[model samples]
Target: MWSQLTKKSVWFIGILFLSLNAYAGHHGMKKDIVDVAAGNENFSTLVAAVKAAGLVDTLKGDGPFTVFAPTNDAFAKLPEGTVEMLLKPENKDKLVAILTYHVVAGKVMAADVVKLSQAETVQGGTAMIKVMDGRVMIDNATVTGTDIKASNGVIHVIDTVLMPK
Candidate 1:
């Protein structure tokens, strides 16, 4: 009798979970990096650069690449016409350099980030690490959110975009 009751209880719980999930809206879901880049209001420039560099597939690949993605506003911080200039077909290499500058090779978490003085970027350049009074910074940008896990890699959101030297 006890085993029968336990089986019934488990069945009831499973049905209830399925029912709840079935009724809930699907729109409120965590998106992958490609979806995030395409939809998020903050990442327009980054998305454009990814497209320009022919890196959309690469970034969407099984990267585990640490992306220091910049916001639209961050791109605005560049000199006037810079974004337009970089997006041109003739400027593809430059776009690749600038975009890759924001990518680090591995999945570096915030805890690990605090310990390191610098990290090498995918562009074959190094990003300077700075911590000040509990705030963590990469290059000139402040890390707004850290350890955002993705299927391929991780994303650490930054307030400003980093440019290569």
Candidate 2:
């Protein structure tokens, strides 16, 4: 009886350990940049633009990209017909340029961003970064949130849609 009880107790403890580890690991897993964007309601417009620009595959690729994602409200803040115009099939190149402008090549978190004066975006232009009064600014837009980790990259939420010059 004693041997049987010990074996049962060991089995129960082993199962409990595995179960807790599995639950913890699942919670700790990070979604990639594209998945993160698609999962969030605030990025709906950005997601639509990415699809319209034919950049879904590229963004979803194995890139440690850093995206300064703009919210739907940010897209709304553009000229009344700008988003509509950009979505047109004929404007694919322009849309691609504009969308790429928001992406940096590496996973630049807020802490590292604050140390930079400017960072070159994938669109071949540099975005001026300013830190003031504990606020971080990328061009005219403000960084509303930061360090949103993804398996393939990171996302920093911005208040304005960045435009390529």
Candidate 3:
């Protein structure tokens, strides 16, 4: 009877270990940049933009893309009509341009970003990065969170939405 009890205890402990491991790995991004945006509550506008641009699948693809995701509060920083205007069908191209501006081709971490003067965005141009006094600034936005790991890419949360010139 003692042997049987020991076996049961061992099995219970094994199951407990597996459960803890699963929970620890829960926030790991599996669907790449798109999934990062989808899973984050602050990035609802970004998710919607990806869906609108029909780039959800592409962003979810096996690309080590780096995305500077903006929160809904970031979108609100735009002019009163800006968000509404961009959402209109007539502004699809413009919206796509702005959204793409936030993406960089490779997985760049905040530590690496501070060393570069500028990095090319997926929007076809480069953005200036400034690191001073331990604060990392990307153009007009401030880096709120860094090195958020995802399955296909990495995510950095920004306080303001970036716009192309």
Q: Give lDDT tens digits, candidate 3, residues 13-80.
A: 99999988797678552456776678878888878877877778878888788988888999989889
Best-first order by TM-score: 2, 3, 1
- Poorest lDDT segment (10 consecutive residues) of candidate 2: 24-33
Query: How many angstroms is residue 39 displaced in model 2 relative to the true structure, after the best TM-score fit?
Result: 0.8
The segments of candidate 2 whose C-alpha lies over 4 angstroms from its true place after superposition are 1-29
Worst 10 residues of 1 by lDDT: 23-32
Overall lDDT per candidate, in order of appearance: 0.84, 0.93, 0.85
Candidate 1 overall Cα lDDT vs. reference? 0.84
Residues 51-161 of candidate 2 have per-residue lDDT tens digits of 999998898888889999999999999999999999999999999999999999988988999999999999999999999898999999999999988887899999999
State which candidate, 2 or 3, has the greater lDDT: 2
Expressed as tens digits, the lDDT of each residue in 30-90 for candidate 1 is 4556666777778878898899889998887766788888888888988899999989999
156: Cα error in model 1, Å: 1.1
Q: TM-score of each candidate?
A: 0.78, 0.84, 0.81
RMSD of each: 7.0, 4.5, 4.3
What CA RMSD would candidate 3 show?
4.3
Candidate 2: the clashing residue pairs are: none
Poorest 10 consecutive residues by lDDT, candidate 3: 27-36
Highest lDDT: which candidate? 2
